[model samples]
Target chain A: MFAAQAFASLFSSPAKTSSPSLASDHPTGGQAAHHAKPLFFTTPHHLKLTYFPIRGLAEDIRLILEESGIAYESENISFHDWHEGGIKQQRAADNPFGQMPILYVNKGEFILSQSKAIIRFIARSTGLDGGDAYSAARCDQLAEGIADLRRQYATLAYDKEFAAKVGDFINKTLVNSFTTIERVYDQNKTRYLLSQDRVSYADIMLFELVDQILALGQDARSVVAKFDRIGEVYKSIAARPRIAAYLASSRRVVAINGASASVGAFKA
Target chain B: MSGDGKYHVHYFAGRGLGEIARIALSEAGVEFEDHRFESLPADLKATTKFGQVPLLVTPAGDRINQSTAILRFIGATHGLSGKTALENAEIDQVIEGVNDIRAKYRALPADAANEERIKFFSTVLPQWLGYFEAILKKTGSGFYVGSNVTIADLYVYVSFDSVINKTADAQPIDAFPLVKAHLEAIAARPRIAAWIAKRPVSQW
Candidate 1:
């Protein structure tokens, strides 16, 4: 079935190049030859990512762009000033939901809000989502898992008894969440989360989530070390050349609390 | 189903996360085993990738969890997903929007007082349903995205159905006529109607 779909796609028009196929292989000669195409057309639009001057939700999108080798402008809006009537009205006016982490594809022609939606859009365009339906489902599952973990962490961070019951939270919530993630990695037995050879958006999300957990002053290393496969996947994603460069560059904002919080209430 | 592989849907006996995929599979005219659990088996619970229900064991025996992922997989495989990226984006937006409302309802404490539920029914339900109504209005094609019945329609239908009819002490949803009409339209589909008639009943 997979082979038949591949064979059919080779002859299909470029317009039929769906998200799954785009994530797998380049368009065939027949499709490209029939159209006027540039040598480098991976990113078909002038991309712009708008968010706060923090790696809160936009960091995963940034990592995906870097991994896909797409050049995009990162416009970090100041959270404090934006709240204090600095572009607040304009920002709300521009976004349908009045939220940050908006992606302006083709400059300002197409606008997309919501971090997950933007991530999926960029992931599909850049071929980082997954190659097929099943793989894509796995990618979505892993990404949702990351979102669930982030939500739990946020709940703990805002809990009034958080400071007092930090140990209990770590043991019950954090460890259990990491265990589930570890099991996912172990079950897949892949270098990345879903794919054996390729790095999907889920890997990037997991890496960022783990990094945030570590940033929260929790002993993330110890928790993840128990799960060798997850640790390896984490190290592999961080060691990606572009990701490594981004991590070391000034472009990477330091983790902060309040407006710049990516991994709970923690200050870098 | 076109594929020769077997299908097994693992979920609790209730029509929770699994109903959307179940409806999609039925809509695709696929035959599969429905594994309903009153209480999750120890081994299955431990072995599930995410330690959750609504896990889909594909014909090839790949255990996939997460309701949205299952919905997307079935949609993509059975020609229920959107035909284009933009259409897919719009579909995803509706799915996410419905999920946002579901999340809000889930966040309410299980032991909450009647006043909270009343508030949710009065303010929150209408606000979210109004958004979906506006979406239906914008499309004007009677579908969530594009000109056909996609998985987004199934999701929204299942969500609205559960909230309006299935939930204990459910509230009336007559304010959003478009949404109610959309629900009626989907419910009238042959396969979906069959599933609705024969599926196990549960108090959600």
Candidate 2:
């Protein structure tokens, strides 16, 4: 079975983010808000990232753009607005998949969707992807491994009975997930996941995933802390100047459920 | 084929994920040891890095999983991915698009009611078919990304033949003329045609 294909539908829907209501409060109350023109067409030679305001699927992409020092326009679409008339009336006109994290490249002429696809595209162009075919494949494998772990975590995190079964989730699923990652670290024995001298996109992806898991709860954090290599990676990546600034800035959406929910889960 | 080390592909005896990589290898004229398992052997399963099949043991003795990653390796090694970053992105987009449709069908429950199945055929299937049709029209190259055949074309072709065409009571592809023609054109490639004729027939 193609697990990637089996789980692709899980990510097909637009990712939702937690944010203060923007329905009435238009922060940028100028021609920009009024016009509501397709951002892709007007923007040129700059990365245009469209996603929910919350740091869900787009968080890693945002970190990449910032770390690359690339000039990008980050549009945080309000969930309320999207449901009302935003996506159908305006956003859907340009996006083929009608999903968030759609990237506009090459002066807005080329539209790329699918978070992983977009991530790889940016990584390759920016040299965050490995130097050669083998290294690149290694990076891709690690990214896919992180994705698989996330998929397994989502099963428990998104469950309606999550609160009651949090212990089971951490013990049975979460620990195993971290162990799998730890094994990869052990095998590679490098500062980075793939043994690349510098940070690759996979390292960034792994850092984000570990950070999210730690954010779940004290139990989650304590368990994840046991993985020394993962802890090292998280610390190193978080200390990067741009990433550090982004984490400290208001741009980083506040944790929704304080360690109980997954990275993208909205507070109940 | 150029390397002295062995290239072994381990997957079940079926035309699933393994087929696309196999097609790419065949198209590139690379020699690899085809290791098909009637059912996954316990030892092999345990040894797999990701506990998954469609694992490509590179000549360098590194084990790789995930079909897309394997395809990328094959494409990069064999020069079928693309010439530039933009072209590779386009190719990735197409492969992901094809995966989206495949996922939708795979998501259907095993005990799905007749109405749900019918709904899939009538609505969902046509929607994706139309999207692929539009893609071919927009590209205007008869291939997915560029002027030449890439791994995306091979993937789209195998997916349509193995998954969409194999569905029970599947609709004909007559509506999407370009997609239909694209499938035929890929199948008629000399090496691909030879593989299709000689490769072991298995029920996916």
Candidate 3:
């Protein structure tokens, strides 16, 4: 009954009716409609990210922001507001898909709504994407591979029967997936995923994937430990001055996943 | 290296994840083998980077896994990629939007009697369609990303084509005028139309 009421309140919020259309001239008013004003892809915008308090998809972008040393702002949408009050309390419904982790350029001058898209945007702007055409393609290859691994990990994290399935996931799924990933990691034979001198966005992605899996407790940790290259790459990324500082800072997200996860739902 | 100078796309027979990569090749006027596997054998699975299909084998015998990765590689090699960094991001946002909805659809049990599944078709699917429709209107170029047909347009077209074909909706895009026009415009393209006609029929 309470859940229903809260949901009702969320839909009935005053901001719900006001579409984030482009004509508003409100400068910061995010025009969310596909029927929005004409937006040309010519310039860059100031960066701000809005997402739930969880680190589900936003972590990689956050890692990029930290490593890039670019000044940015982050807004967290609490579960309470999303259910009882509507997310518009933080900002208007500017997201295309109404999903979080939306990157607002110049406070809604433009809103990029996908995590992978946002990651590539920031990574490119910050020079963390890659150096040349060939290296850039390799970065994409690594990121996509990490994404597949993340999918398997996400299923385990969100499974209602998490306890029942986690062991099998660790033994079979984790092992098999890593076998292929590690092989790719071994291909470059370098200190970083991309080059000996530069760490690309794919390295950050790999680091976070390893970190999240490590949070699944000792057995899961043991499974991931076998991937020496992934571990080596993870350590190198963590040791970066900005990244190291960020890890110990208050801005770092403590929660590894959502509260529904069977494990590592640590809250800041 | 095979030294055959032909790309080989390995995936299940249907146009699922592999369709975008296949579409990229088709759009670029590249001839490649559409290697289908009804059941992926363990030996082949072991060789892939993520133990997943929709892997692309370049003419050089480099095995690339993940559907999007293969698509990106093809987009880069060919002219299917965005004209600029910002344009590239625009293309990716559209592709990811399609992927996001597909993930939601995949989570649903395929029972017409299922309440959630019914809600998905009735509510969730329309909401997503409106989102895409809005994007089409905003771009105003009759394309998703920029002024040209890119991998973004290909991804959007195949995703909706598969979905509506499954539902057998006579007028799936009726409520979405721009999306409707975009679908027709994409379908009428010579290569895409030819591929659609020649492709194998399967129960998606």
Q: Write one digit per residue (lDDT tens) for candidate 1, span B1-204.
A: 233377789888888888887898888777788889899999888878888988888766677789998887777666677655555656776787777778778776655466777688778788777767776776788997767898999999988777777455555567788888899999999989998898987876
Model 2 lDDT per residue over B1-204, tens place: 233377788899998888887898888677788889888889877776666788888765768888888888777666566545556667887887887788777767666467777788788888788878877876788987767788899999999997667766776578999999999999999989988898898888
Q: Is candidate 1 or candidate 2 better by TM-score?
A: 1
Per-residue lDDT for A145-177 in model 1, tens only?
888887676666566676666566566777888
TM-scores, each model vs. reference: 0.84, 0.82, 0.84
lDDT of 3 by residue, B1-204 (tens): 454767898889888888878887887777899988789978777676666788888776767777776776666556566555556677888888898888887888877788888888878888899989877876779998767787889888888887765774324568898998898998889988888788888776
Clashing pairs in 3: A20-A31, A20-A32, A34-B134, A34-B135, A35-B134
Off by over 4 Å in 2: A1-44, A155-169, A255-268, B1-4, B112-118
For all candidates in order, the CA lDDT equals 0.72, 0.72, 0.74
Better of 1 and 2 by DockQ: 1
lDDT string for model 3 (A13-128, tens) is: 21223432221332322212111112222233467888778778999999988897776788887766765686654443465666667887665655677899999877765667
**Native-referenced Cα lDDT, model 2:** 0.72
Off by over 4 Å in 1: A1-43, A80-98, A194-197, A218-221, A256-268, B1-4, B111-118, B166-172
Clashes of each: 1, 4, 5
Per-residue lDDT of A132 in model 2: 60
Error of 3 at A210 (Å): 1.4
